[model samples]
Target: MHNEVRSVDGGSSLVQAQYIGTVNQQLPGPERVVPHETPRALRRLVGRNEQIEACLADQRVPLVVFDGLTGVGRRALARYVAEQVKDRYPGGAYYTDYATHTVDGESVISAALRSLLRRDGVRDEVMPAEPGLASLWRRRSSGAAAVLLLENVTESEQFLQLMPGGRDWLVLVAGRVESRLEVREVGGETIPVEPLDDEQAAELFRELSGLDADPDDPVVAEILGYCGGLPLALRNAATLVVVGRCPSLPELAARLRRSRAELMRSDRGPNKGNPVFEATYQEATEPAQRAYRLLGAYPAIDFTPPVFDLLIGLDEATSRDILAELVLLKVLQEEHGRYSMHPLVHDHAASLSGLDDEETHEALARVVRGFRNAAYYADAAMIGVERYRVADAPEIADPFSGDRRANGLAWFEENRRALHELLPVAEKIGLVDEIWQIAESLAAYYFDRKRQADSLSSLRHGIKAAEEAGNRAAEARLRSLASRPLTDLEQFEQAGDFVRRSIELADQDGHLVLRASVREFAGRYHDLTDQPELAQQRYRESIELNEAAGEARGEALSRMFLGQSLGDAEGLRELETAHRAFGELGDSRSAARALLITGQVRVRTGLPGGVDALTAAAEAFQTSGATFYEAQAREALHGALVVENPVEARSHLDRAIQLYRELGSPRAEKLASENDGGLDGAES
Candidate 1:
């Protein structure tokens, strides 16, 4: 979640209005095995119910333009609205801030398309031109459903190009407007978000500051006057009182008066924080100020305590404590253990911290180092065929420790968006090495989620970086990594070419581990292309090379894939051996794959434990967050059960088809076609 401070709407009805919310949900490329909770619920949205209800009522409208003053809760309103109706968009509700950073050269349409395609699980390498990406979004969304909250869009032309070209999906565009003209030009119904009325402001202050003052109290009115009733300033004023910087609300009000008196017209302009941020900044403790400014350098999204540790280079305990203090001050909001700063607050902090370029640069380096290490370790845990492992990196605390819901796969899924955002940030600072490392580390998650496009995108970056760094071994490995996704995408010729190039590079560099790994992809391409003989030969060569390199995981997987594609008694022997290797290595996904293949072979031989083996494989895949593989295991079971138990087989096939369709895999067509109008061919 980008910003999480929604204000009360005082129950004003909307003729037409749309609010922008930042996207916080990760793709299945991010969702992983299961979601542990619902979207974070609102604490209290004052003065915003009518606007929300009106937007919900006008479902056919498809687009709503939320025009409001800065700090008046536009992002908050959008977030509130998304939470209210997310169920309607089964594809998921997403938030993105297209507030255009300095080096973001893409057109507004390109940015919008990127957001939409990313939501649809299309990674950047496969990302098409604007029109085509939008077309892909239209086709995908029309069939399923989606919601996008686009924040910081300044013109009608921006959102106009992003409209679904149909009415099935909903988009809310939020921005500050000098007039309703832009909103009118976009043809969206406009919802103007006003500041809180007296009653709401009083309630908000008491809630935030622990103040007992009533609505009619002179002190309360005086404070609200300086805040202009904007939730941003009002909350900052209340924070001053709550944090003991002011002895009372009256003192806070007086301080605000002095700050506004000192402000130049330029400093008090509309884009400004109305002198409130200045007063709050002046009053905050030194540590709090430093934490706030450092927080601005973090990504524009929800983050965890460990991220703070990365941002400020503080120990985890101190970093977490600082964040907790900010939460109490209403400068940050905590939801289900993740904390987010309102954009206005982040902007305010960012504006003040322009004096420390060197420290800021080092802080950013810490962030890169942290992400690179996390991605490396997380990938290691998820997949076992280790071509390499990052050695001797600093031990960083797991950011997802607060939730207790993550293993390797779940961790990758959770941080997918954050990692994506960090790629550009690393590039901007010339952390070229970190950029490719992070991208390569995330390859396993993208592969399992069937996000071939995303995998290819990351691999391309790694390849470019390796070439630039003149690291032939890394270039070969990246080429091998790049081909796996191409194989998945069924671009067999393209995949094989990469494999061939990788082999040449590995041979030139005498990289044995690299050669072994690239050969596995080569074998897979042959296997997928129905040349089982060629696949078997390639797998044998891979196994020989891996054995020479002493890579147990690679050797085991080569045997598993070769045996599975062969479908003979000898194959079963190989699978059993591979399964034992994976299980002993604690690599659950590969273990599951081996078991699934062995189970199918067992069923062919009329063995009693065929279903049991497949069952265990499914369970393993589920626990490890290999959802697509889980579905594949289920499909194999369906095939095995078709002869002995038609009813069970139908159920299994139904589930497999459902998952395949959801993932948009071509396997769904084959599975559905094989079912052929209700299992009419079942029985021996």
Candidate 2:
């Protein structure tokens, strides 16, 4: 049932029809589909061996411009080099295609400004609507240390604007037209990609089409000559040959000449192929053209199902068919369920669309906002936000302004990866308010699930973006957000610095919510660093702030943490206070967590009620959807039960141990194991 359509043979003069294996044969489905766009390894592409040696030997290339003609594969070579020397540019990595030098033929700078914005992934800062876009682009790229690929550029101003930025950035410009671009701040050597010599052209043809295709044949030489050593031309020719359309190279040359004429006469009929692209693009329907241009608006390599609905105005089947056709024509590449235009093809399509820059921006913004909306709902469920639904609702939930605390915890777990992906786009678009909301939602998931790596990555980036955007509330939240993982990793000094920053930001912004959150996180950090008195002081302060803000849930959480820390500090009186606060919040999971900590406190003091508290907590946690807490609570209850009731103790301990083992939690297992051994020893 494989639905793969292989290229037609080069030897055939006629366009070889697609082979339908059998009329009754089933179609290839999702299970049979192979992955399409696995990023090729860096070693596989060109010009990188020298760059690698230079980077490794610490030689300075201050600026190396890889400049060339359109579709000459210069950008690909640059990308390969970037991949190779990524370690050298550790500050960051930036890629931009400068192909669209005309936004309604306004200014090359405006076109480049849009690309630069796309490159940095910067959003949310108030920017001028139009005209002076280049000034803004120049300002943003000047400071970063990264690599910039200036693709398909024409004017010197594009390079001049970017020259002031990216101290360590390597700028590679690719296109048919060169700017003779020069800068005073940095001297760069240009590596011009000349038209391939006959030998190289022949080699390219052989690689694309095979050696079996007669090299001595005049037809082969004819097609190669027509292509004029252009890599793009060679690629398209090879595709035609594989489909068995132009059997002989001479025939390809003849057909291409005919295509050129047809393209020139396009005003005569309307559907004739583009003169520049030859006749290949003319074969596409208007709907396909619309789809091609619309798909280019999404920044990410992949698109969700909803993208088809939003961007292209066709039904799913029709859109998928058009997309598949474009991929066949080599204008688009399909990967998973998503599609992307080759960067050059993307430029061509954009130029053809006639849509102005503002229109393009508006369309792109809508798509990104839609993506954010979907991911937000998913994340909301994972963090115990219950009110948000998967379908159409009256109001869109705002992570920052909305009552996110009211949503049930499930939102965070369901949309964790989606939320993670949304972070960069959210920041780039200057959605500062959204960034803060995401940080809060993610904080709960990161701590509860122990996703330390992701927590650090997401929070740190958000913090920087928030600070840059001057969103005081977001800055304050991220200050606390950055502390948790460092504390977990035993980086105490760094953890304390983050907490202090959070406090400073909160105080400057006068955000009581952020202030309270920081106080609680500081308590956690202090306890991790073995400063119990400081931890106790921070915990009480967090509780007081939450109470003053009238934030019942925050107050409850702070009370729970205070009790746990004090209980760990061997203060039993705080357990009753923690229990009361948690009960007020009506959070079964937190209440259960409180009970487990209380039981541990009681166990240290040899209190008679330890087993009862643990048993009750285990029951509550089991229904709260967390396997880890349930197992721990059960183990605690089993330990207390072991001293008085062996049968009941063994029953609970066995299940607890099995559950803990399944969850890969060694601490919970140890507790269950010790209780089991004690009961068995008592019986013996």
Candidate 3:
């Protein structure tokens, strides 16, 4: 019996069996091969008209390969061509990314086949195994006129495995220029996709930037030249302009000229830099090549110039020159004076056979140590010197020299992701001391920013490392720090347990400041759990311990908490004293917290000047990057003003909602829901 094929909507084909002879058995037709939708193409194609026309010039060619340097827009061009000719193949256009789908350098042809078959109504249990996938695919797709767009194809064999057996089928492959020879042997026509021309690059930049300027303008010309006619570079440059990073064309041009590196490096979409970067690295200067290899092994996502110098073991000027050269080569990307490699480029650089194991390990160790030292300095500058800190601040030149507190907090905020990335790397290399110490340094920043989840995760890791190294003081500090995030996350039982353990550890270790800190956390846990009397007792104990240890900051902080628990005239007096002490100690952030609590209590009790106090506190928190507290102050101000001035109250609520949303706080949604349908019709 033979089957007659019928095309259906959505690129599926049905079959009807035609039986002959005496036997009257009707066999089921082949399963419908439901075509996967083609990958989304760029909203607009730029400077690929010639390539598109060539690909479509001969409709009879079954295979077409668009090969070029990475980020030259090969994938985008192929996607555009496939979309344009989609109607020619009724079986529909199917798409898959080979780079994403492959496993351990082997093409996962079975996954591709299974995806196609499953979508075509094939049941999972009835599906064929790996060896049978290609046979089934060919059998099912025999008469189906379809288009296949295989992106980032690395080998010709991958193409052969997925190729349909029909003469009418068209396969469009996109990969690096090196893949052209292998694909050509399989009758695939190679189309070399070059960088955009000057005019096209200029148009793309103008379109993306939403800027209207003469093409001959000096700044515009400088940008175009720096982009080197690459669409990826042009898009990123335009992004920098649109985001107000450079503010104007001239500023962007000057930045480009000064750094000789693309400021805005994006790894979005199919812009992998590995293929072209490998060749670029091979041709770069020895110093630039060494920088690339070492940087690839660097754990952090990005680094400043000083850190770069340390990592490369070079002097300041020499390292800067090497960085400029690598940036000019497009191997390293620099953004706002910090240098980093694209993840794909980093992977390639790391894979290169340059540094031996010991050299790489030592280089990475130096970078980690540099970060640790800087973190300790920033921590001290931002929060004052905490006696509970296990690691001493190394006697290095201070990185944050001016406006120490502001700059320290700013540095932590800027490198937060890099700091988080370094933890596992440090742990892997047995830098246990560094791991706990870095986590300890980040605790205050984390708490002020309301990154409770991150705080909890980092503290847990630090606690583990401290315990592993048998460092009781570090373990005690980390455990006490864990309570804050746990309490904020509403894991009250866990928070209380951590507080108890921390108190015990501090006593056993015989550290007065550590014991004071743990006592304050215990008081916080009690307050959160609504045991005001017990909370006050813990706070009083903490105050005595801090005073005994001559730690005025800890004593003042505990007094602030004690005042909050009191919630009366005496409580107000305590808050006033704590605020004054913090101001005298030059700890403005802690002063602001004390003022915030006082304002909150006054607002709740309908006291005068509550709004004024909240407004001042909010401003301070905003200035200090204490985003969570700022939101709290805003919420308090809204509550205080809602009855008397609904319009102003709504404004405060709006700002609070925005800040909470930015911080990923659930309070954002809660406030939004509570205020929904126009707060007292004031919004209308």
Q: Which candidate number maximizes TM-score? A: 3
Question: What TM-score does candidate 3 get on C-alpha atoms?
Answer: 0.60
Over the stretch 84-195, how does candidate 1's per-residue lDDT look in tens digits? 7777775566665665422366676677677656655676766667557666766655654567777766556666666664456677777644335655665567787766
lDDT of 3 by residue, 1-684 (tens): 578898999999987867645754444546665565787778778888888888877557888888665667878888988888888888887887765664654346667777766665666767776888888877867786888898866556667788887878999888643345666676778887767777888898888888864568877887887776777777777877888987688888888776543422434645432244554677678988877888877766578998788778988989888988776555666678887665446656766633446767777778888888888888877866753576777888877777777788888888778878878877877889988988998897787677888888888889989999999889988998899889877898988888999988889998788888888888878887889899899999999999999999889988998988887788889999999999998888788888888887787667776678888988998887777778888888888788889899899999999998998878799998998312210000
Off by over 4 Å in 1: 1-70, 73-293, 315-325, 343-356, 384-387, 390-406, 531-533, 583-589, 601-613, 619-625, 654-684
TM agreement with the true structure for every prediction: 0.55, 0.48, 0.60
- What is the Å distance of residue 258 in model 2 from its true position? 37
Which candidate would rank higher by lDDT, 1 or 2?
1
Candidate 2: TM-score? Answer: 0.48
Descending-lDDT candidate ranking: 3, 1, 2
Native-referenced Cα lDDT, model 3: 0.78
